[model samples]
Structures are given as structure tokens and as C-alpha cells.
Target: MDTDTIDGQPRVVATDAALAFIDEIRKDYPDILFHQSGGCCDGSSPMCYPADDYIVGDRDVKLGEIGGVPVYISASQFEVWRHTQLIIDVVPGRGGMFSLDNGRERRFLTRSRMFDGGEACAIPLVKRG
Candidate 1:
């Protein structure tokens, strides 16, 4: 369900269940985005919001798009996560308090895996594009 990648390795991706959840969310909210929380009340979950509602800061890093929505992480968080791909998945739980997925009986989870040498090298330079 991932929408973009770099040389066959995805910078961010979503599971089929996550994609389905996104589709469900799109029914009521069309323009949305995902921001990976760097630990807080949500515990590092991917928080979805109405694009116009959240202010994406200048220092935020857009890893890629998943489910037709842009996925971002703070620059500081990206420093630690840059070497890995973000795998967005849906699980049974409450979502972040302010996230769009809240009250939906499911939440967006951020899972990751470290990239191989080549992928790690290819990722950092193009985070903004």
C-alpha cells in the first residue's frame, strides 16, 4: 500500500489494513497527512490529521507518501530514523487523542526496519523531495 519509494526500498509504507483504514477515514476527511510522533501521549504512533489543521513545521522531514497522503517526521526524529523505512500499520487500540483515527477502534502504528547500506546512503540526501 506504499505509494512511493527510492530504488525499490520504501521510505514509508502502509499495510493493506492501514490503507483500508485510510480509505475509511477519507470518507469524512479527504485532505489528510501523517506525522510520526517522537514519543509523547501517543507513544510514537503515526498521527493523521486534516492537512489544513496541522502546521507542518519548517524543520519537519517528509519521508514519503503512503495511501496518497504525505508522511512526515521531525528533523530530529528523522536523524534517528533516516536509516530505516517507516512501515505504517493499523492495530486495535485507541489512537492519539488529537489524531483523526481516534474513536475509530483502531490506530496507526509506526513500525520500522533498518535499511541496508545502499538504501541508507540513498535516503538522507533526498528527504525533502
Candidate 2:
């Protein structure tokens, strides 16, 4: 999937800095995925993991992809974030304890913006089980 925009409007996006960081991470773990934390120990940060290390379950909703890696959120969290565009970026800090980003010093952060009427209507509907 495209990094940010789908068709035209974006459901999830990443800054250039974040994309660069993702590329760096990819050098080590070619196959990776992201799951937006639901305010557990990570405080809602975007967590990265090797695809083999994490299981994408039915409760996870695929919002979009970034740097060719898929990003997902829990169905319950999706309900709360459905109206906004998720912006994935990097910040100087520690990552989630169990996330791949943990030892990197820099962590993935999730910022967002509410979709306007047109964007909201244009965004694709995600089917969750």
C-alpha cells in the first residue's frame, strides 16, 4: 500500500524524518509492521515489530501503510480514531518496552488531524471482523 494517501486523502501518513527512520529500521528487519498502542505502558505511541514477532489478529484494523509496512490499530481504538488521519513521526525518546523501536533511542510517535467533510467522505471504509 501507499505510504500515506489512499487514492487522494490519507488515512495514515508519515513525515520524511519518520520514513527515513523506517528505512533504517528496515535495514535490520526487512519485514516489519506497526500497531498503535492503546495507552498501555507506551502511552499511545506507535509500536514497531518484526512481522514474525507480532500477530495481526481480527481485532486489529488496518488503517494504512507507511514505507511499505502495514499499520494497524485495535478495533476499539479504531472506533475512536476513525475520523482522524494518523501521522507517524519520530521523536527523541524511548519506545515501547516490547516494541522493536525500544533500543533505538528514537521512537515512533503518532500525531493526528481530524478529517474535513470531503476527506471524511473520500476516505475508504475499513472492514473489521
| Predicted structure with the largest lDDT when compared to the true one | 1
Q: What is each predicted model's overall lDDT from 0 to 1?
A: 0.85, 0.84
Where's the lowest-lDDT run of ten residues in candidate 1? 120-129
Cα-based TM-score, every candidate: 0.89, 0.87
| C-alpha lDDT of candidate 2 relative to the true structure | 0.84
Best by TM-score: 1
- Stretches > 4 Å off in candidate 1: 1-6, 125-129
For candidate 2, report its TM-score.
0.87
Clashes of 2: 0
Give the alpha carbon lDDT tens digit for every residue of 28-53 in model 1. 99999999998768889999999999
**How much is 125 displaced in model 1, in angstroms?**
5.7
> What does candidate 2's lDDT look like per residue over 1-129, in tens digits?
232454477688899999999999999999999999997578889999999999998778888888899998887888787778899999998889988888899999999999886767655555654
